[model samples]
Target chain A: MNPIAQYPFEISVEKVLKSSMVADPLTLLDCSPLTDGAAAIILAREDIAKKYTDTPVYLTGSGQASDTLALHDRSSLTGVLAAKIASEKAYKMAGVTAKDIPVAEVHDCFSIAELMAIEDIGFVSKGEGGKFVQDGQTKIGGKVAVNTSGGLKACGHPVGATGIKQAAEIVIQLRGDAGKRQVDGAEIGLTHNVGGSGATCVVNIFRR
Target chain B: MHKTSVPGVWRRFKNRYQIVGTQCETCKTNFYPPRELCPKCRRGGKISEKKFAGLGKIVTYTRVHAAPAGYEKQVPYAVAIVQLEEGPMLTTQIVDYNTDELKIGQSVRATFRKMYEDGDEGIIHYGTKFTPIRES
Candidate 1:
């Protein structure tokens, strides 16, 4: 779905199977490679933003939560507790639910992480993320377009820059600046970013 | 780590060698990697040292062929997140096991073993690792 290949290039599924294992159930293909890259965003006050542009995307609501740094310290492994907490707070503050979002950018450091994030952020039922994607619900024209920016896997994971990168992508989507990857009539967008084994998570909701 | 500093290991040696953790008297909850203060019961919880039975069940596992720096030679080693019977989970490598039989929910018990060496001629790190329980 991604047109531009940055640091990590596209590989066939067969090649993924042949790749060396990084951890059980996860091959190198399942993980995003580190890249030397950076991203930036411009946040302005309402008055300043209006001076800059007539159709400014408004920063609606945001929420953050933290969990244990070690997976051993976590009680649940099925989904990220931090992400769930943060997304709930954000959605409540924004007065929006997952159903209201048209486009979303989520952290997908690993392939499984994408699905897990989708579920945690309330994009789908707790255990229905896999079926949602399988049914093409995450595609550009589906129920909710997820990772319209190709995620960390295809866009290249620049580590510290990923949070800002996610927000920037959502901004682009909301502003209708995304070229071919744009979601049609996207009035509301959301971004989910996780840090350090779910130790920290921040979910921000944006609207045009 | 490939070139792990010496004192860094020594500082946490006691915690590493033993399955010692903290238990909250107020909440009746256990914490591995012991915590002095209880987050849930900040002022009321009485923290006490607890030694686990080292018995656990496999929650999930993975085999690492691309080992980290110091463990490069230990290629294709098995690792797992074992949920301790005491209500804590640990990320540890598994040893002395049949690869084909390693499945989720399989019973395991912690055993003291060599974790890894820093490098050739470097100190060998000893700690707890899980092994498939003989009877289970």
Candidate 2:
């Protein structure tokens, strides 16, 4: 058996399937697909950045935090505290609150992840994430746009490359390069990447 | 082997059949899949082996349609993390239940099973697994 698989931690499924043992009423198929890929982003100062493209965005705030690797020590399994810390730093750097983030590309390795990101990034209150999605607050044109690239659920998780991929996607959206997944007139954005059951998380805020 | 060491050795082997873990005396923290030290407290205090009932809650899992090189044949299998009642979580094959029946927070019990057999007639690897506790 893989040694890491045997690590002490909590596990939960965020998506439902037609077949399963009701083990948390979630299924494996609903989880994000682990993948292998690479992504990159180019950053430049505002004054000299105009040459690269007509619009240049700023990476305002960024933070990364770690939590108990074992899920048993966590106060709540459904959400991650590390993400909240990272988001706070990013939000503050952007000179905005959750309300200013018109669209976001979050880590949705599982369907429930998008919901959790909503709360972790301060977009909504804890436990209210599920409702936010159900209410269409995270849809393309609603209050915010989330995971338009199909997220980890549909896209893929290449581990070391997932974080960079998110940054690339945000840049595309800010530059209106996301083809069909682009958000209309997105001025500010956020990205959240988590590692190993929320033990590690990074939040980055950007402005166009 | 010396008689004085026999009892301790036997006890150690017996722990393999069950999910045995270690707890740091100073930190009061337990480790799953067993470890030598406390990751949280960072203090390498007294460590003691402890047996844990495999009963746990299902956190999240995945049905691997495509596995790594060695596990290619066992496609469409279930892998999940079960949060033990005492503390710590374990990842193991979930079997004897429909894949659709998986749910978050569902209770399960450990069982011994063939993890994978080697070669055509080589050694059969045994490992721990979990299944839904059938409610009467």
Candidate 3:
């Protein structure tokens, strides 16, 4: 079956079929598709960036970390420790905290993954992420706009392209180029990308 | 199909069959899919082989309907993060139960099973999978 045609949010007869194809509690809708795509952005020093674009999005800080290749080797299954470490380093280097960022592009390969990313990156306290999302805190114009690009969940995760895609989304938001989905007055944004289960993670902070 | 050589299979026999892992002497940390060095202690920590009891519980799980390249036959299978009794956690398939029957914190124990056959000419790989521990 062409899974892309069966996105749960879209109205289609295939949606019902796709929903039933997976075991209960998690359907195909919860997972990201293996898509083919690419994304790229030219980054430069502040002086060079200012010369290139009037509204240059500054790459304030970047951090990366790795854990065990296998998911089970990690201490906590609920959150990605690598993500936590990476984001913390990014935040420190950027001289900002999660609350300081009003918008973010998070890795949401699976629905559950988004929840874990929010918590792991310190947007919400551990175990409170589900509630935070449920309360509409992650929606555009909420406490923090997350996945303004529709995320990997709807944006289509092209493995190698995911990190670049995330960065592009954040840069677009910080540059005030995102059309209707743009978060109002978004000055600072963050992008998170994970490889494999949670083995590798990269976090980048961008500011207008 | 994925290919596995005789030596590759032989090297992991102790871990796949007996669940042997490693423990760091300096920090007393344990590892599954055993590592040669302690990430925390690096070169300073001494490592020693340790055998696990093969008993643990599910920390979290997902019913993977989308099978990867060579695992199409195992579609809709339950995979979980199992925390072993000693300390280390490992990702392994949970067998002999339906999705509804599994839950976080449910007790489980390792059982030998066929992971997959590489190909017609390749080795039939074996590994430990977890199953719900039946209450007596």
Candidate 4:
């Protein structure tokens, strides 16, 4: 399937191409579209979870962290520190590490964001994210299946709804309801969301 | 079309116009958007005003095709994270040169420019932007 056709909104391919920097080479295809949408999920206590559904997807752990609002204030530009910190906390609370996650829905507002996220979450060594993806480690049936739901790159990014959308994708994967994009025997899944550059990050772990 | 109060503009005038930042007298760390208290020193740090040299090199950059509401006219502009000589990074637009000239580690110098103009009756916003310094 043509990836561009999968986008719900029309992408301004020309504008993206024209804006490309000589050194960085970012075409419009490398960026996520501005979308208008929303997503919501129901939360239930463990006791009442079964009342809602028999195969209740449990939220094992969640973590959130913040940094300076402006991108310039951050100490490092290569990775989102907040993401690294938040994911570490989430992994600790879930009693699992990055290596244990079989599937993940990560923020890909920009293609670079997804690359940096994998590294920040410790799925790959720092500065090796680009090479890791190129090596097919992030592909389904590879080391880790990432963005099986098309991610923000193919999926639309409604600013306020992005975080919830990421969680919903992970839940669908955990429930084995993500037909065609399901990761076989996926017992653990993770979702990562970031706000404005590297200012805020939230990481959640879910288990079936 | 955006409405910015006089005081809001006034508060940021120094930093926006002159690149005035803050330094932690205790830890010797410099901050770009002048902070009242240093994060490293917390309540124990003594903060002092420091004027930046307004010169730096580009660390990373992006060509923004989609801009926020007010910056629509400036679409396809180049914005970069420049590491200032004083050891603080700042986000500013790269102007007065072709986008092809931009590269990581290229030297740049800050220049004051009009960021945006409000509605006809609104005040014009001015801030610092960067330009590549040509080598002899």
Which has the greatest TM-score?
A: 1
Models sorted by TM-score, best on top: 1, 4, 3, 2
Better of 1 and 2 by DockQ: 1
Candidate 2 segments exceeding 4 Å error: A1-38, A45-54, A68-75, A153-161, A176-182, B1-16, B53-85, B93-110, B130-136
For A1-208, candidate 2 gives per-residue lDDT tens digits of 1111211232333324553422243455556656767777777778778887787778988888889787656767678899988888777767789998887878887667778888988889988988888898887888998876667766667778888877877887888877666799998888899997899899998887
| Model 4, runs deviating above 4 Å | A1-24, B1-12, B98-101
* Candidate 4: clashing pairs of residues: none
Using DockQ as the measure, the top candidate is: 1
Question: Native-vs-model 2 lDDT?
Answer: 0.76
Candidate 1's C-alpha lDDT?
Answer: 0.86
Residue-wise C-alpha lDDT for candidate 3, range B26-129, written one tens digit per residue: 99998887889999999999999998999999998878776776678888788888899998888899999855559999899999998887877887777799
Per-candidate TM-scores read: 0.91, 0.69, 0.83, 0.85
User: What is the TM-score of candidate 1?
Assistant: 0.91
Candidate 3 per-residue lDDT, tens place, A1-208, comes to 1133213254343663467445445677677877887889997888987787788888888999999777666677789999999999999999999999899999998888999999999999999999999899999879999987778867788889889989998888787778777788999999999997889999999988
Indicate the residue-level lDDT of A101 in model 2. 86
- Per-residue accuracy of model 1 over A108-146 as CA lDDT, tens digit each: 899889999999998888889899998999989999999
What tens-digit string does per-residue lDDT give for candidate 1 at B8-98? 8675656688888989999988988788998999999999989888899999888888877888877888888898899978899988899
Worst 10 residues of 1 chain B by lDDT: B6-15
Q: Which stretches of candidate 3 lie over 4 Å from their true place?
A: A1-24, B1-12, B24-30, B40-46, B98-101
Error of 3 at A176 (Å): 2.2
Model 4, CA-based lDDT: 0.86
